[model samples]
Target: MVLRAWPLEGIGEIRPGDDLAAIIVDHLTEPLEAGDVVVVTSKVVSKAAGLATAGDRDSLIDAETDRVVARRGQTRIVRTHSGLTLAAAGIDASNLEAGSVIPLPRDPDGAARDLRGRLEDLAGVRLGVIVSDTAGRAWRIGQTDIAIGASGVAPYLSFAGVEDAYGNLLAVTSPAIADEIAGTAELVAGKLDGQPVVVVRGLPAAWLDSDEGAAALIRDDDGDLFGLGARDAVLAAVSRGELPRGFPVADEGDDLLALARAGTDLSLADVTVAADGSLEVRALSEDGAPEAHVEAGALAERLRILARALRREIVIAVVSD
Candidate 1:
């Protein structure tokens, strides 16, 4: 099967309350085909919705984040209200004028659905719409576009109970086809090319749908193995004001220095306590239980509180590796 993806040019800069659908329609170099998928970049959607704010970046980031996943100096990963775990909650500072930042659409699925309706009416063809944004991966370098919002497209294709080419039954084999489409379409939508919309044609009929938005791509934290960054996992758990069973206590001299052997059988190395009382705790995954940091964080937080009571500075580092 052959597919074609081309970005709509000359759409110009989208302003607040601009007719996004009509703008794309007016810039169409060719007509949209039936079953064609319209890929819209989230930046333009934010601009149209006036979500591009000059507000304080830190406050804006905090307002959009649900929780911090990890942090090291200036970089941080966070989970947003949209159930998406991304860098800075997908609040980007690129492609906009300096001193301004753009955030993803508050309701991208709704935006895609609205755009799809307008496109169908103008072109008189059935189609799918995917609102996309660039995102980083957990264990991989660089970034790729993903479906942040979707309408009239199957956000994922599950292969459970199906056979592979080798005739083996598939179990946890669902592919996020919507993200794949968005990523593939991104090839033609260059970063500095001013191309925000791409028309992806030639996907299977079963891939198109009238429901199932991009939220389908998000896995619940309860079932996600890597939901929390190793350190943040510990920090969040420790913030609950509880310690792991059989861990150290502050009264027992288990201060910031006690984390080296904090876990009963867990051993941490390169334990450094900074002048300001910040800690750097590194643990190899092959060491004790992989999830020891969660408990370790709890242990560290308990000690940190004790230090604070004594008017001392304290911080702990639990390397996720």
Candidate 2:
């Protein structure tokens, strides 16, 4: 129930192809126990793995980003190819040599597993390894270190189906223990500190046996309600851009109905849904204003956008006067 964590001091600078496992073993102020969890910053992992790249930071971010979740002014919160949603795709530019940036490890979970194996061999004890990274949260200020990768650790402690003392059944009470350990370690291995590693001891033995890794902590689209930002959703819907997997599919004719009920835009035209499920759009200009075709074309584009958002195939039959 009680955990003790401390940073490993006297660990010197890490560079490309450094033997991180050997460095950790050499600097152990105390011996690691079986239930101890080793938390490491991804910065060092990237460095040791030779992941440092000299390129435009923006280009690096773009290479790591799978899709953009939100954009406000100059900051973009993107979902990385590793399924992590964070600003700048978790690239580190600060606190490193200039003219180079480090993207997150190509495979963080794999990195954690490799580190865990190496540590166990070196330290002669069973252990859990967590690759940590600092990330900004949604609707929260500042940042906190979270476990982006883990090995030989239970990612979550699920209390679902467990009854409380008050006789209440817990339906959804799962804590991400890997992230907790990472955040706890971050408290001691601070940003200003040269420490990049921390040892957390006294965790429950049961929590240390799983090899599920940190990927279990990532929620799929079915469980993620806020996959896209509000403005991003609006822009995607209006521009016929592809929606993230989280958006729900609309019922039949929903797209057409929404377009027909649109105000102002429909004032210059008549939009009707026919029996064949095609949109029948007629330009209504009494004096045959040349703008009618323009309005009709704009409406057709809008119709396509709506259909795309609703996940439906729309056929528009336009009759211009």
**Candidate 1 residues 1-321, lDDT tens each?**
798899998888889999888898899998889999999999998999999989887778777777666664467677787778788788888878889988788888888898889989988999999999999997899999999999999999888999989999999998899999999889988878899999999998988975989998888877788876665455334344332221111222334344323432344233556576577555535667645665556545555654554345556666555
Name the best candidate (by lDDT).
2
Q: What stretches of model 2 exceed 4 Å from their correct place?
A: 244-321
- In terms of lDDT, model 2 sits at 0.82
Model 2: residue 272 alpha-carbon error in angstroms:
24
RMSD, candidate 1, Å: 9.9
Residue 215, candidate 1: C-alpha displacement in angstroms: 0.2
Q: Rate the local accuracy (lDDT) of all candidates.
A: 0.77, 0.82
Q: Worst 10-residue stretch by lDDT in candidate 2? A: 245-254
What TM value does model 1 have? 0.77
Off by over 4 Å in 1: 238-321
